[model samples]
Target: MPKVSVKVKWGKEMYPDVEVNTDDEPVVFKAQIFALTGVQPERQKVVCKGVTLRDDSWANFKLSNNALVLVMGSKEEDVPAAPVEQTRFVEDMNESELATALDLPEGLINLGNTCYMNATVQCLKTVPELKNALLGYDPSSGGGTAGGLTSALSETMRALESGGAGACAAAAARLLNALHAAAPRLAERGAGGQLAQQDASECWTEIVRALRMRLTVAPEPNSKSLIEQYFGGTLDVELVCSEADEPPTRSNETFLQLSCFISQDVKYLQSGLRSKMAEQITKMSETLGRDAVYTKTSKISRLPAYLTVQFVRFYYKEKESINAKILKDVKFPLELDVYELCSPELQERLTPMRNKFKELEDASVEKSLNAKNKSHGDSKKENKKRSIVPYWFENDVGSNNSGYYRLQAVLTHRGRSSSSGHYVAWVARGDAWLRCDDDTVSPVTEEEVLKLSGGGDWHCAYLLLYGPKILEVPEEEEEPMVTDVTEGPAGNPPTALA
Candidate 1:
């Protein structure tokens, strides 16, 4: 036996740092070298056979002090060439490589990113059969383990169909649950399936349509109950003016002036109505008093023997006469039927003004009817034609107030057109005398004027009083009408209240 010395290098860059001792017996030497260097004993064989002494022949060897000592022999043969060193390295390991080596389903391999891979794994866990299939044993395949779990599911469904009932229920339930869980994952990947994508698109389309409809038919919140029966809900509202070239002006002055207008409507001057109206006026005065001026004027016209009551509410930050801060000047033409219930003397005195008022109201109604009739024939054509004279007041009042009153007659125009069977109303509030004969003249009917005098339109009037006094309207009680039991076949009586 010959002894040999061995050295081992480890890691990427070989470093000459490890040495091992071999015994005289090559087998024992190899084993000892392997034990010391932790290299395979078989790999150390080449070193065992190549040792020699100074005689240039095979050396006899023996172990001494954990090292090999060689003894020269009489015969020597060609020394074996030093064995070439070889190293083995395993290929780098990763998810894809591991999945491939284990023969996993290609679907899992196709997951583009780690997030999707994790999501899919989570979804599959809920399906016991699918999980088992991935783990190499598929219950769906009739007690045999198969790699084609998807195919096994399909075959199971087919068998259930052939078996005539209930065989696939549990599997179907599991698949549905899996699909539901996986849907959100697919959406994040922007890979929503065809059916889901279509449903989402349709829902968005309906929402857009609803918004457009609301914009078109704007409705107020207070009007909700009245319109909801027909329109179903409140609508989005926006205010638009006709003049495009002239931008509307708004200021704190305008706000105060408008507040004056609102004050006049809230305050009623008639003696009989004063107490109830005074309370409202007082409330409104508190809100507008800081920036507004209030004045009242009464004129007696002999021809009509009627009282011309004028209330002017002016609002401005600076001190000035009411006429100096005029934002709008409108003269409302009104007709009163004093003859309907009045003394002969009063009627005689009112004859001239009453006649003039009636003529103006009639002429205004006729003109409006003509325009409406003309519009009916060709509304599109009529819309293109500009009016030569604008009837309604066309001034932007310089105030932020919601209401005001000026020493101007406010007219209410109303009439029924034969062509379009609906009552129309037009209110004009200005300072000039109404000229009825003019084609542009706008007049208000008697009923409309009364409505305005009684504190705005019907709705506003109802709201003003409905708040606290609604409980005051006495509920009517009806007396019951009874029918005799003899007349009703001796069992019961009939009552009208029923």
Candidate 2:
């Protein structure tokens, strides 16, 4: 039996084409169709060349390359009426089975107004490299490449190593334990029955602090901490004014999280980030001897593999003595290009990788066109591996030379204020989107993730984690150009010896 790549069509729509092995049970093939079509495996009716494929036998159909398939099925099965005799809660269900069946990351239990904490943890957990680093690093050893960490929370972090119920819980628990060590009162709820709310950004900082000190960059023992490896960035900030006599001032600053300030005109996430960098102020400068106009500009000195951008939608309202949220629509792109934010030198350094990325995009388009027209068997074999592994750059410690990033996780908050609002995390795992709202996790779509931008504010994206975009390059080298010995010169071809 041979594996055949087939184009599947349902009704008038064409599903993503798939490659299937004719040797496996048709059920296995059905599952692949399920993932593509949202049609349940049990209910699918796959027809190829006027033959209805059977579950047990795939070989009997004699399927081959470029085969056309018609998959007929429903999105889901009809459920019977619920039994009124008994009521069940989430706790009553089997946790392991529920989580395992859905392949969900473990979720954290919301401790009062700890949704902020939970949201941050869930979002950070989406970084596979960070997770791998956490899984390997020995917290008790008191050894880290990043020198700023304190070993005070060593025993607490080690306790998290024992076991956890789900991925969310494991990540949140470790972070919470570390946070508690930093400030004991943070984990406790005050007299108002509801737990006192803490700033989500503060939670982010402390959690990253613990991780940076505890986690080591294995390759370089004392290079930089894990936090710096993924999130750290340096920016050159310049202050200039309209006055000819006033000299401009410049300084450098480090940042782990970039902020986006929302305003009346702000309708997109990237615009908000730009607004945060440009500061317009009317102030009297003592050195300038009069009121001077000043505007601040900032540009990236270093770009980390993971870029965390926070939307600064909250401001303290004096009337209620509480932090209030801005409900404004800010559309954020799934793929972001930060070329404009980089310094001229860094931008020049990025040109090669940027060109490589453009070449990859061109190649992918050509490949898709080739597959559509050529109908060659080799196209299926060529696509077997999609992920681009062993990706690298020259001097690649903390450089996103391509300046391209794909959104991997989003932390969103709903309601008017930081303390009272609910928080959720939308994480991209493989090609699927999963929304983790405290303990309840459900599969979501890219469209749903997009809708998180804050118009009417169901859930507004508060923070975004963007990971480097890698290109899938062909592993095989191109054949060397054949030397045309017969053509001796450009003007004429030399006569070949008989």
Candidate 3:
């Protein structure tokens, strides 16, 4: 089939010279009509000679050159409730229109070598709790770097939310100023007197610290600050002196992030994390009365709703006077189960939720198989929406119920070192992912994202943000709806189908 030029008629207006390709899906034809009428494909209803057009096929209708077709739908803004039926890119729709139609978040513009800051900002915006805390932040709460950063960040987030398809350099510039003023190292210039590119993980740490100072709203009554509540965790530490005949010393420490030291043996993220958890160090031993070798062991006693993991890929090269990166291929999982990383008591506490997750997975497999068997032909399987429950603990609002998490964002660095590299943020958006390379935001596949696991000069994952995995309550024990009744006419309403 060949391309045919047709004129489309919408309510009172007519769009002529619209090109439609007969060989492609009918949705493609709708896209052509969308280009002319500003109506999204999902909301569009195409009719020709009283026969309706379906998205899957166009076999019933014969489209010819100069043929008149009827299209009906409101503009994208008018139908805000309509779901996105397809992925539309810059080639299909302009940036402004794409943002408006898909409700995609705006991108941040780079100010000189500020991609690091931009990437961090974009990744942090994925956290709803943090954004809400920032929205309620008061600059008068404190004075100095923390206050300035809080104020700047609050405004930047607001602008990013509402300023669609617009430049975000001004907000980013204020943030850069606040950060540079707080951390002098970030303000250092290159040999050419140009602003130096900084590390995204460092930027992330400083911003988290600043927000922790100003956004003091606790997740629960009489708790720590919002940042700590959502991002902080506790580690149970034990030190056994090698030369002393005494019991091991025990203590607890709070941390904002976990570091994964990447060595030659570190082939996966979990392995690196486990190696860091226990190590041999030389420290002052009170029992031995001297500096002695001791075995230091650490286990997580508390897991926050949001977890930050940094790959220790950079090492200081004294001769080169630069931090060189290691290009090792370390695989990471999209869904992570950190049960092995928790303390014994913490692991026991996390068991119930972990069991529930296992049940859900089993049931999901069964349901999928049943659906596949019931289908008459080789029809594609329908992607069923999983039942979602709160990721946080029921008793603790900002703590994880299970030692499981789903990767939400990844900050990758390209080039030899963090100081002279490009930084980009890859954030999960529903089932899709978006790559924010400074000002340019584009859709990327999960495979593309996973390829950032190093092994080459390509972009490698430097920092990862994992949010607690959404628990799916089993159908047998699903919470009863408000309409559920103990005694219904239809024998208890057939167990109130979930």
Best by TM-score: 3
Please give, for residues 1-498, the per-residue lDDT of candidate 1 as tens digits. 233333332223232323323311233333232333333322222321234321111245332333433222111123455644343222543443333334321111111111122222222222222222223322343321111223333333343224221222223322222332333332232232111111211222222222222211113423211111111211111122222222222221100000113332334333312222222211113333442222221111111111122223123433432222122222222422213222344345445434434565586588678875665545564345221111101121110011111222231211111111111112222212221210112232334333543221221110010000000111121112211211211111111110
RMSDs, each prediction?
42.1, 20.6, 17.5
| Segments of candidate 2 deviating more than 4 angstroms | 1-101, 142-177, 184-188, 218-222, 282-286, 289-291, 375-381, 384-392, 477-498
By lDDT, the better pick of 2 and 3 is: 3
Local distance difference test, each candidate: 0.24, 0.67, 0.76
Q: Where in model 1 is the C-alpha error above 4 Å? A: 1-267, 271-343, 372-498
Poorest 10 consecutive residues of model 1 by lDDT?
462-471
TM-score of each: 0.13, 0.68, 0.72
The full ranking of all candidates by TM-score, starting with the best, is 3, 2, 1
Worst lDDT run of 10 residues, candidate 3, spans: 489-498
As for TM-score, the candidate ahead, 2 or 3, is 3
lDDT (10s digit) by residue, model 2, range 87-107:
545565454434533566555
276-395 per-residue lDDT for model 3 (tens digits): 999999998777678999899999999998899999989999999899999899998898888899999999889887887898789779877787466644333333333455555555
Give the candidates in order of lDDT, highest first. 3, 2, 1
At residue 158, candidate 3 shows an lDDT of 80
